[model samples]
Target: YNIHPSEKLIQAFRKKPYQGCCPIQAEFLFIGLDANYAYDIEEQKIFPKVIEYHKDAISFWKKYNVHHPFLLDGYKGDGRKYHKEFSKIRLTCEDSSRISFIELLHLPTTGRNNLRNTDLDKNHLKYIHQAIVSQYTKAVFISDAVFRLMKKTSTFSWMQDAREIEGYSLKVFHETSPLIYKHLHFSTYGKFQAQKEKEMKAIHMIISKI
Candidate 1:
């Protein structure tokens, strides 16, 4: 019997837990060739669908080879590896009551270039974004100005009258390094984020000391 690729992920995560940055029952994005898909920045678009309910599931990471981690040569070719990485992250960070939601209100306008200083294909990114919307409810996304830059042929179109998710708060920042494939970098955005949080707490400690 053939199982849906997604259904397989769901069943696996139920038996274990996720490690690293991915959230519990939280959705993610996958972008690559149709034959072997993975993750990309476009996955942020699915943020609206995941806020109300919590369930057990695993979302695929865009695969990368160990030989040339930066080049998009081939899929990692190991579903079990994906499962293990996610499971370990989930188990390690089981106490997440301290985390908070942050809305990327400017993504539709600015795109990933709004954060990173690189030009990327908007259509490819849109494909990844669509996948995210299909998976999770409260995923992060781009602003209209950012989205305009990612387009293929047209100049730019702003998504005016865009509405915010109910009961959600917004936080805008000049920089955003996401939590995808962060394990590859020597010091990943995940590490940097943790450091930033630690620094903030340290300042608080100093303030209390004074």
Candidate 2:
């Protein structure tokens, strides 16, 4: 019932989280990223900066052992599988892999950010989101100045009006919007990300011109 990782893993995970323009879940930061032509300059504005890895949260992650999606909010296992196959990496206890897994799963975008009926299968999509998001992980790009400006924000009222927000975006952007809730329940991971990039590029292009 527990993932008793070696003390080495605990120490390894204690390392700090990267700070910068949180590309993931950073809805407003993208606006800044477009203005600077570089992520470095724009990421400073957002409050409660995103952490590279929630080290303390790691213990909670291990508490679940088998991933069931509801990681922090309520620990409710909805019966649908989360394919935490990726989490297995953290169990290795080797510093390299434990740290690497952090980069691999920046933050699971599927469950918390976007969710559909528990009836839907996400085993395949989880694998895809992990790969695309990890490519630009913070350990590689964030600077001390950036980290200095960032602080971890609390996850409060994050899902306040799920349907209204989800529906509005879906209505306006249709399938192209970056609203993961639109696709998490219906589209392929590649399609969702591709549209996300498109939306990002479109916004950046518009903002940079002004």
Candidate 3:
């Protein structure tokens, strides 16, 4: 498979840097490091349909009809292992429409090790800001690496009073909105199975507080 995004998709990204179902006014936002696959013209072809289907958080998760290419496993039985772990926490709550997922870097690549800082320019930061603003996100679940990067930027500069939880950390600027939890990347959850329950509980606690 060609690992380069199509020109059309690249232009589309200049307007909307996020892939997958991102609902309007999402309560829970999960931010990943980067995309795992480069999107081609075929992927671009379905963008409109996907956007139409993802009208709101409730519609996006209704019967679990999520339509993201990377998250197709979610529509199947158990989904990917990391998604399964995310589901565990999501299931703890009643409103499914309040959850959403996005990435720090919209550019697609095979893995994080292959990515460079140059890939995350001003447009990417603007996209993140736009996502948070448009969605009115209540809480943000971020990977450790992405957290480190965002910390240097003004977007996450408001984050203060870091509290550690099961080897992960949670940062908050206020008593209520936009609780930012910094955790080990979901891809590494399987390797730390022994600590999974603890981490899940801690994450659930954060969700409940929000």
Candidate 4:
């Protein structure tokens, strides 16, 4: 399937508070906090250009049948740990092609702790909602932080049932339209190594139902 972002969605991404790439539409959406690469105000002036660059990259990969850079293994850099964890979840899925990702905050920082604030504008939340509704998103794996943020904003207020999975929570919006799973931030997996396997099992259980 050659899924593409709509022009309106692309505009939403362009006007995001921070610099980041637009997510591809897919069945599974992974929501995170923010990126690790920070750009100065001057550099951020070209955010529109950066968005176009990412759009072009997505088009090139789709045309060549190459894996999305976000799904590639052996990545090295600030977000390597998070990338590794995402790879594990991707592997757990029966069809990796159905997965894609987006960040609640487009701002890039070396660490969440370093960020002065996490306040987001309406556009950021709209971008995520659009990403979900635009595709046949069957499931969403959200980082604990992002999940909490959504809860505070009542973004998933319609979701009334949540099933606990080894400390994590899996919420089903309906019979199976979209299953929202909340787990610890992927970057902190190293600190909770003891529960890694259990979390993976929980993730597998969720995917099995998908």
RMSD of each: 14.9, 18.3, 5.4, 7.9
Error (Å) of candidate 4 at residue 82 is: 0.5
State the displacement of the C-alpha of residue 38, model 1, in Å, after optimal TM-score superposition: 19
Candidate with the greatest lDDT versus the true structure: 3
lDDT of 2 at 134: 51
Higher-ranked by TM-score: 1 or 2: 1
By descending lDDT, how would the candidates be arranged? Answer: 3, 4, 1, 2
Error of 2 at 15 (Å): 4.0
In candidate 3, which residue pairs get closer than 3 Å at backbone N, Cα or C atoms, i.e. clash? 57-97
What is the Cα-based TM-score of model 4?
0.60
Query: TM-score for each prediction?
Result: 0.24, 0.21, 0.64, 0.60
- Please write out the lDDT profile of model 1 over residues 1-210, one tens digit for every residue: 112244333343233222212332334321111111123212333311111111212121112111111122332332323333323222212222211111112121211123331333454344344433433423333333333333332322222333433332322211122312111211124546564344334323322332
Candidate 1 has a TM-score of 0.24
lDDT of each: 0.27, 0.25, 0.54, 0.51
Clashing pairs in 4: none
Task: Write model 2 residue lDDT over 53-88, tens digit each, in one string.
Answer: 234333433443432222233232221222232232
Stronger candidate by lDDT (1 vs 4): 4
